[model samples]
Target: MQKYTVLLLINFFLLLANYSSAAANDSFTLGVIADCQYAEQANKGTRYYTSCPDKLSTAVEQFNTLPLSGVLHLGDFIDRDFQNFTVLNTISSVLNTPLYHVLGNHEFSIDDSLKMRVPETLHMPARYYSFEINNWLFIALDGNDVSTYGWPKTSKRHKRNIALFNTKYKGHEDWNGAIGAKQLKWLERKLNTAQTQKQPVVLLSHFPIYPENNHNLWNAQEVLTLISQYSTVKAWFNGHNHVGNYAQKDGVHFVTFHAMLDTDSTAFSTIEFSPNQLVINGQGRQPSMVLPIN
Candidate 1:
């Protein structure tokens, strides 16, 4: 009887030790789905527009089974039509966790009068906003704010964007956009607050800000410079180029997730954030990589 009691105490101690170890290594996972671009329209180029609904369904079903803190759709949730938002929402409803969105340029493809309605359709509180999960701050930026493609031709903002594109960034076209002065100030404030709180940040946008691609944001350099100024900023996740890309600048990881609209296969990812590293568990066409955080 005494031997059995000793064994029981030993087992209890072992279990307690394991629990403490797990608590010490606590990590969180985020479900990432980019560029669903769902529509009833037929395929265009490599984008299988009609396949997105089914693909999103699969992604949601899979994400529901994982231990995700939340799910983030990087943008371009629809291709062109407003009607496609209904389909995208229905498919995304299967997710058991909270879902967040970033506004993509394609979201404004509807009539100029209805351009502001896109955020409402997505149920976002604002065009750009911030949220927190597990001691980390996530900022979602609206890359279409100063773009010529989404605004009415006669609008001042549209004209200004066109002029800026033509004069300074002639190489970039209407599809790319810049972050206006107001948004830039707001972003700076958010970063300052996060730094004051000693919280790490992950930025989300629809337009890529690095790799010097044609699909990059019109003011990529400005955004990159702002982000580089903040040591608390750890990663920038985006989606615009369907091919996908990754880069690291000033200890910040810039990851452009592959578009879910491309190919019949689904493209999504589960990103696990630990104290030392960021682990990406990619599904379908999304490539996996583990990045060390400074």
Candidate 2:
């Protein structure tokens, strides 16, 4: 009986050590691209709209060579033309892995009658939704939910957005936008569930929420406060500002990637998440950074 008990104890210790080592070795890489803003227009100021297709093709070729679990476009996949969506589709289809998209203001730049088709074109389940990948929750938000530029001028939501912009934001601009009340509630529920499940979260939005700027979401402060309530949120990724920015608050990392539209060169990155740290491997013009996970 003593010999059997000693063998059982040794087996249990060995299994425990193996589990620890496996957990430490677990990691996943995610491909990230933002503000592709593809269009067949001449260069306007800093944005080279006509050059995005070649840039996207290059990005897709690079991503295909990488061992990424999935790819996420932080939005502005096209500029202001509905025709550009077809070009985007052609360029992005070369990606061999799963691809996800978040809606940006440019998605609604078409006529109001065709605005509803944008989501379907991008293969998004909804304007705002959540998905799970390797024990992490990714939440994609629609910042254009209340934008004057995105919503139809005759619609009540557009009027409400204008009123809010005038009164609350002091008429910031039609380019800026906010998440609606329903979406806010949905986000809260998702965060609560993630907390209960002990899952880490990576939030994706088209508008910046931190390091306040003209391109930030209209209700950015509210969104920031809401996210800070949940400890499970590890990072927030965004675009819209185009210049790119980074900040950390209350244990969450806010990272904004540069717009692919700005230059003739490409801008994209792959992010690897490990047990202890998050590493961003930038390609083209995107800047790399290493962030420790809490």
Candidate 3:
């Protein structure tokens, strides 16, 4: 509880100094990137992707040039590696701002034999975690692992909960996009804390949280129920779809963005916020769209 309490206290001050009530202005810039998907040394036949560290390096250069608050990568930072995670590690060091992430399917390509390799190359203190930024509780969730979930059904103490999930979401995407029971519990605690502070929540996950919105989380309904319980969740941002667009349910917004670099043709989104409204601007593409982040 001390850890949780201390985390809350830290965010309280951070949010006060960072968050704004000015309504999403054309200022207070942040970079929205995803699916950098860098692979080292592509084969002779593959023109769709090139193993270009400089491409990422260029992106870092762009980040450094821009006066931005931070960067959120929706995942797939690399196309390969477990034991030797060269691609992501290289990019992590190059970027000068705070980097936040969600897990793409590629990040979990490692086998248990090489399980020692982790998300740590980015220097994240915790893998699945949350933080407060500009009056928002941004949650970074891992969407590819569910077998290790410590849920009620999997935990034996809550057969009823397991039965409920089995009835609704069994056999979905082989059940990979799960929050598991433990993370859901942790989320509940976070939601309560955010609620008490009157802060809105934003979920940053590799997989989409809603069913009709996109690829759909393995346990989409389970997650939806959780979101419904929290009035503070302002939106969910994702990037596996590789196509830039928006999805909305009631007041919650979901934005699925395109990849960064992979074929010499990629995209990056710029999100500008002030106080109430947030605008996501898609760049380096034909006929870009600007979406309201509220």
Report the error of model 2 at residue 129, Å. 0.4
Evaluate residue 11 in candidate 2 and report its C-alpha lDDT on the 0 to 100 scale. 100
Each candidate structure's count of clashing pairs? 0, 0, 7
- TM-scores for all candidates: the values are 0.90, 0.92, 0.76
- lDDT by residue (39-96, candidate 3, tens digit) is 6555444223454455556667787888777888887776656633665566667677
Model 2 is weakest, by summed lDDT over 10 consecutive residues, at 165-174
Residue-level lDDT tens digits of model 2 in 189-260: 999999999999999999998987889998999999999999999999998889899999999999999998
* Count of backbone collisions within predicted model 3: 7
Global lDDT of each model?
Answer: 0.89, 0.90, 0.66
lDDT of 1 by residue, 1-294 (tens): 999999999999999999878755568999998899877776888889888888888889899998789999999999898888988888887788989999998898877777767888898999999999888999999888777786777788788878777887787777878888899999999999999998999999999998788888888999988989999999999998888999998999999999999978889999999877899999999999999989
Model 1: how far is 172 from its true place, Å? Answer: 1.5
Distance from true position, residue 175, model 1, in Å?
Answer: 0.7
Tell me which of candidates 1 and 2 scores higher on lDDT: 2
- Higher-TM-score candidate of 1 and 3: 1
Best by TM-score: 2
